[model samples]
Target: MEGAPQGTGYVVNLDEKLGRIDEHWKPRVVAQMNDYQFKLVKICGDFVWHSHADTDETFFVIDGEVRIDLRGGPVVIRAGELFVVPKGVEHKPYAEHEASIMLIEPCGVLNTGDARNERTAQNDMWL
Candidate 1:
């Protein structure tokens, strides 16, 4: 995102970008830093329980709210809040209504983490 081509700009209007998505649980990359990628995703219902084996996953709630059910207890994140699931910590996220979120993780990291299946989203899908 920093190395824009000549006259290109790095600033992205989040509202405009988020409007382009029509599916749940699918993340579209918006920016990059080093080997990490920042993605925008809209989620609803429940997500698969999984864990990242090698890197921590950061979640920033942009709108609505989400309940992250961890092995111990649930961590609810509302809009304007952020949470980080440590590496290898098994957890599942749920939302009663649609929630807009931004994920900061290593490039190519799978959304379903170690539990790869039909629900595993395609990685590095840029918006």
Candidate 2:
């Protein structure tokens, strides 16, 4: 099995990889090793309120601001901020303009959480 990178991997150009993302609200897996996977998602507007039943989701804001509504306690994640939504806590993500985010989660995380919606993707798109 391939091991995780010890440090930043200089071989892959992130800008070139980011160029492959063309769809909004869709997440594409960019890197994976062991039980972890890295995904890039471009988002705008309000997303459906939901939560993962099994695994926690971590969001790292790459660019722009994203507001995560946690029902009673909401937080605004700006560029360079990282937030983790604990498993089974319902939350909604919104952005006024296009925002780029990176997600760190175990493989097989469903973006839409428990409730299936039009945003639920059938397969993990790689970009």
Candidate 3:
């Protein structure tokens, strides 16, 4: 209600969109600009270690905390914090508890980047 879109252009409520997500590791599209898309996902446990060769990946934490394991060290991102993993840099995302996050990246970028496995999620899922 409070964050619901008004009678105008698209106005997304991140909380409202996040409430619809029922699974971990699956990202659902919420908004798109130019050739990029804004995605929301709930994460827990560990994600695959991977990298995007053609584009950078952005992670914005909305709730709880996230730890990104990079070669240099682990970067912790709390709610309201954002981090960008540069293109071709391998990283892994992990959360001890469930965390809501937004990912900003170009369309067609796989969730697992170049690594494909049981952890790889379908592309272009919208909420």
TM-score for every candidate vs. truth?
0.92, 0.87, 0.93
Please provide, for model 2 over 1-127, each residue's C-alpha lDDT reduced to its tens digit, 9 standing for 90 to 100: 1242332353554556667778788887777767777888889999999999999999999889999999898899999999999999999999999999998898878888897989887545555
How would you order the candidates by lDDT, starting with the best?
3, 1, 2
Model 1 spans > 4 angstroms off:
1-9
- The alpha-carbon lDDT assigned to residue 24 of candidate 2 equals 80
Which is the leading candidate under lDDT?
3
Q: Which ten residues in a row have the lowest lDDT in candidate 1?
A: 1-10
Residue 96 deviation, candidate 2, in Å?
A: 0.6
Which candidate, 1 or 2, has the higher lDDT? 1
Q: Any residue pairs clashing in model 2, and if so which?
A: none
lDDT of 3 by residue, 26-80 (tens): 9988888888889999999999999999999999999999999999999999999
Q: Which rank order by TM-score, best down to worst?
A: 3, 1, 2
Clashes of each: 0, 0, 0
What stretches of model 2 exceed 4 Å from their correct place?
1-10
